[model samples]
Target: MTKDTTILLIGHGSRGREGNKETINFAAQWRERHPEWRIEVCFIEHAEVLLDEGLDRAARNAKKVLAIPFILNAAGHVKMELPHALAEARQRHPEVEFLVTRHLGMGREILAVLQGQLDQQIKAMSVPDPMTTGVILLGRGSSDAGANGELAKMARWIFEDNDHELVDLAFTGVTWPRLETVVQRQVKLGMMQIAIVPVYLFTGVLIERIKEQVARLQNQYPQVSFALGTHFGFDKGIFDLLDSKVNGDIEEGGMLECDGCKYREAAEEEHLHDHSHTAIGGGGCAHGHDHQHEHGHSHAHGCSHKHD
Candidate 1:
């Protein structure tokens, strides 16, 4: 086992089989590219391959491990839970250096990926021309108010900046403007054709459910033509986007020197969900990490720590 030889991709697990498979698929893609690099996939909960289990299997032959979370946002798991688990792995395999990479957020390339998916969906529907039609960005909303707010903000910036006719950010669960409500809103806005772009990194039951919800709305508003978009799964562009996040600055030992990471400050204002007292490695972004959230619930904005 040599240094920096193994990679472990981590995902927030779900009870749905396909939700978990997306992470496994990502691992498979990484393995395909870096066959020599030992790779394993793990989950945060609701299934097997817990971080420790993956670490245990890779520890014997791998001197270095990078626990790259497949989650889309930086929340408690990436900030707290997984790091705690990584800390344990570090102690047990003292010789093996460990790195826990940041989750995906605010990447320009991702925006491109999403825009491309929307474009493709428009083309597939053969709806005369898509540039004139409206598009709605949908997602599995989160309980983290900050995270939910961030997505809505991002959606607004994207919509306004791109000159799209109408782009409403809606959620599938625990948030307002659910598919039906948003559909009605779009109807009121005089959008005859709409595309429901699931703002997710992978396909799963949530997308299916959202589609079902859309179907019921279609019955009510048959004049409103809707198209379901694809998730950003295992795409080369996505991999490149993740690769860009890894920079020369990642210390060899996988530890930050202090509390003030430059990226955190930029992200602090982005999430609208409260993190009043939450600590990432013992430092507050803006609101601390103590913002309260009940399981599978949310008041606003969305983040990745929640499983799809």
Candidate 2:
């Protein structure tokens, strides 16, 4: 909340130009909304400014730095990479206090955004009968089983209150039930209409790939009407979620689920040997932190996380 406090907004950097621009634009808008704190945007990989450079710039003139990962799920980047970077930064800039906030995990705000997208896609259909139509909530799949499970959980959440006959989950790559496979299965199950909802934050190569796949599927199944839903781009609900994270309004119970995380399991395995690195959801920092480790400074708030 203070001018001296810097917000190091870390994004999962992309190789595509538009993807990186989306993050930069979002950070600019966030800065405009909350002018009190200094905001610095950086990426985890494949970007001009990486995390290390971003940390240096953020810690240079700020008394306290709040590092927030602008990623949806707690994958390897959130669980491993970001924490390690922060830990190294803390050691280098011991004069500055550092606070790490939770990633944008599944919450009401995220659900609301997805619900809105689904509504829009359904409404655009010529025959929006939920009984005959099927919806596929597609995600950028991860090797992390827990992160993939989160997508499945989200699909179930979307189906619970809705009238949709079938709500299924699929991944772009690196996992089972791929988009094309799901589309074929749904068609065989007598789905006259299918909507593919991409659970992405920005337009990138993956988005384009999804679009291309939909086009191919449309040609393959001319009788089945397929509608592609939009990604969560600069939505108000997402902004609210990020604000809650920064302000510490979200309860710890709603933080990232670490029970099934492979990284957490590995860290626990190492802990037997007195290793210092702790799980993200645990009391200690993501990298290495003893139970009693303290920054000696205070701040207002506060991912193997990646995106396509």
The most accurate candidate by TM-score is: 2
Clashes of each: 19, 10
lDDT of 1 by residue, 1-308 (tens): 33456767777787778878887887777667656657777888866778788777767777777667777755555554565567678889999877756566545676777778877877777854444567787877765565666577667766866656778888888767787787787788778788878887766777778767877887888887778876776768777765554433254457422123332332344442232223335333333333333443222322223211
Q: Which residue runs does candidate 2 get wrong by more than 4 Å? A: 249-308
- Deviation (Å) of 172 in candidate 2: 0.6
In model 2, how large is the Cα lDDT of residue 37? 57
What does candidate 2 score on TM? 0.82
User: Which regions of candidate 1 are displaced past 4 Å?
Assistant: 1-4, 127-132, 245-284, 288-308
Cα-based TM-score, every candidate: 0.78, 0.82
- Sliding window of 10 residues with minimal summed lDDT for model 1: 299-308
**lDDT by candidate, in order shown:** 0.65, 0.77
